[model samples]
Target: MGDNIRYKFDYLIDKGFYWSIGLRSSFSHFNKNITASLLLNDTEIDAMGLNKIGVELQDQTNQFYLQTLFRKDFALSIGAEHKRLEITSETLATNNVDEEFVFENTDYFSFYSNLKLDTYDDKYFPKNGVYFNGDLHWYLYASHFNKTFDAFSIAKADIGYAFSITDKLAVNLKSGGGFKLGDKTTQTLDFALGGYGNNLINNFVPFLGYDFISLTGNSYVKAYAGLDYNWLKKHHITLEANWANIDDDIFDTGEWFTLPDYRGYALGYAVDTFVGPIQVKYSYSPEQTKGFWYFTLGFWF
Candidate 1:
């Protein structure tokens, strides 16, 4: 079970000057039990285990972005973001022979930036120009609870191009890699399995493209394809369904998930609309982890 929430805002002045900001926070709890039995002729044995786990997580993030137009056909941008994450976990387990209880809490923070180039005239692709882009990211992560764990600072750079293949299809591709800036805590924790401290390595993600959507309005469909390359090459595919109504946007409700760097299967559905300068969205993710569901509500202005 989980609860989460987030708030985001962005603004563009004089058509080319841009500025934006965002924030988000969340929590989760979990439990499970299992029993097994075996029989052989006149001999029989049985075993059972019960596990209870509770996790409380909180995350706060802030971002600022500024982009300036050098001319009608060119622009330059700079942005910065800050994130803080705090997590606490408690577990109780019992088996035929042993019983145990565990508790842990961790806090982490990161800061990063982006630089990009835009070539599109901000029109329909077939009638508009193409966009070529290159950007670099510098990030820092530190954990308060675990110091030996290497604090991390890394930089990544990427180049890509985006254009509409047709009136209904468009695509973009980008590839980037990150390396540690200095000797820092590299250990990570696995909360779901109740485990601790694991080495962290540099990460690489590759580029791919797809047709996102054509239809717009009360209902729409979007699809994406991409690949992740780190320890091994992993393929990723996504399909999304969206629907809306008059009284309220069905997509505007719930809490946002706090974990951001996780790779797993996810499915979400929501409805949303605008109130003044604010936009609100709500989504539910089932199959988050076996029999678990996550709900998130977000507001953007």
Candidate 2:
């Protein structure tokens, strides 16, 4: 609905589970770049330095997918994504050739097959069950004929388990991992653990020990465990802990944000309930120093 973001959603097939085919498309654009100084505390402290770092990035991505469920617990999905990324410099009041910084446009393409299984007691909110998802994708450099980055394969899997511990308490666990077969990879293709949705690795730690995104790499393995109790109607209290580590490729990158030297095993608390039409989750993390505020999106339960 906004100029910065444009999106359209449509289901080629509207029938329920009995139906076997469907199509979905998504589009988005962004105006994101280093508009401010790294030392944000003083934006104007170094005007020229700030302008030197002023890299305006225009990003647009269009994605579409077709999926069919030919079997009871399996779905075969094929998707294609194209990205047009342009980088430019915003030379502020002073226009000096040396001060301007820009990079060549990048055209990225991805094609993939995603298979999902839903065997949980409940898909959206499960009390006791198991869920597994696996996907493999191919990243193709369509715009470059140099062959430096022709193509590569990446595979990822997620496994989750939940069962009751007592009449009043239950335990839940989830593990995820991934690998890239080809040695060639771009920073954009790197893996990360944090933020909303599936990126929430550990229940006790949010934001990769700082913010909602961090601890990135080409390969990763993470696990989380927690006990939940429901004493009130439609409300649960959870206590949990999580641990995660990335492959050596992370250290090889030598970039802290992309792959920071981090230690997992943080503990936290969460309370889950529905407040009117919104799902409310309150999580508390007492060990992180990167100013990780508790996310209200997900809980251990």
Candidate 3:
């Protein structure tokens, strides 16, 4: 569990120019103690000296950014960020688990530029328009613990479009991807892809039917399509499908027709309540043993 702190200030200027500066910081700790057989393959289980292994992780990040927007729909921002991670792993050994695996802490600094565009008709329920956002980061410096690269670059973009198909039906399509540039990079720059909820920092992408941040990759391409039908003025039904290809290597070239490694589908019903919208959904993934049920209030993040 962890906590996040954020502060921001905004200034308005002439000719539709909007400027703001912000700071965001967070800290988290994770304890991973599990039976080796549950997570390891047969070969891995045999190699492990302990029947159970445990890992403790600590993560922290601090970021500062100054951004400006021209007109109303497009904006650009630049920021600097520092991130640190420490991991310690324990396992049993022949001599009473004397041996332990400890990885050197990883700490790094980066400068990033972000651009965004949004023309959606509604923030809670978009029946028309498009949204686009992109980010580019250059890792120019790092602590001595980082032996991977002196400098590298990462780029990411997300685009979506929604349109009304009929009096009470709408179609929504979205595609997003990211990759590392340059020959040298660090695992710290990889993307974490899974789950769906509010916006997340540090290259986290929301994909339905999976556990939160359950998948990691150096690069990825994902697409989503959904149909929303308003059978009644305040009641709705929806169907969704998602597909993606996640890779450990940087930016692979492929067409959407190429078979993807991940796929998921969901059906949902929602009602607009006095306070917000209440939704119930059932999601399925072929890779999983069974489907998942979700119930939520307010707009679907």
Candidate 3 pairs with clashing backbones: 93-97
The ten-residue window of minimal lDDT in model 2 covers 198-207
Model 1 lDDT, full chain set: 0.30
| Tens digits of per-residue lDDT for model 2, 1-301 | 4665555555666344554444444444444333232212233536345522344545555657777674766776788877665655554433575654444367778888888877777443356888778888787765762235557777887788988867667778887767676754343354655533422211112332333334445666666676667666556665555556664344345432342234443333434445321233333334455434344444322
Index of the highest-TM-score prediction: 3
What's the TM-score of every candidate structure?
A: 0.38, 0.65, 0.75
Ranking by TM-score: 3, 2, 1
List RMSD in Å for every model shown: 16.4, 7.4, 5.2
Top candidate by lDDT:
3
lDDT of 3 at 247: 63
lDDT of 3: 0.72
Model 1 per-residue lDDT tens digits across residues 1-301: 2344433344445444443333323222223221111001112211223222243434454555566555444455556655554433333343532533322233444544445555544211112344433334344444455545554444434344445444434444333222334442231221011110111111212111101111111111112221221121111122222111111111232111222122223232333323211111122223122322333233321
lDDT (Cα, 0-100) at 50 in candidate 3: 48
- Give the C-alpha miss distance for residue 112 in model 2, angstroms: 0.7
Better of 2 and 3 by TM-score: 3
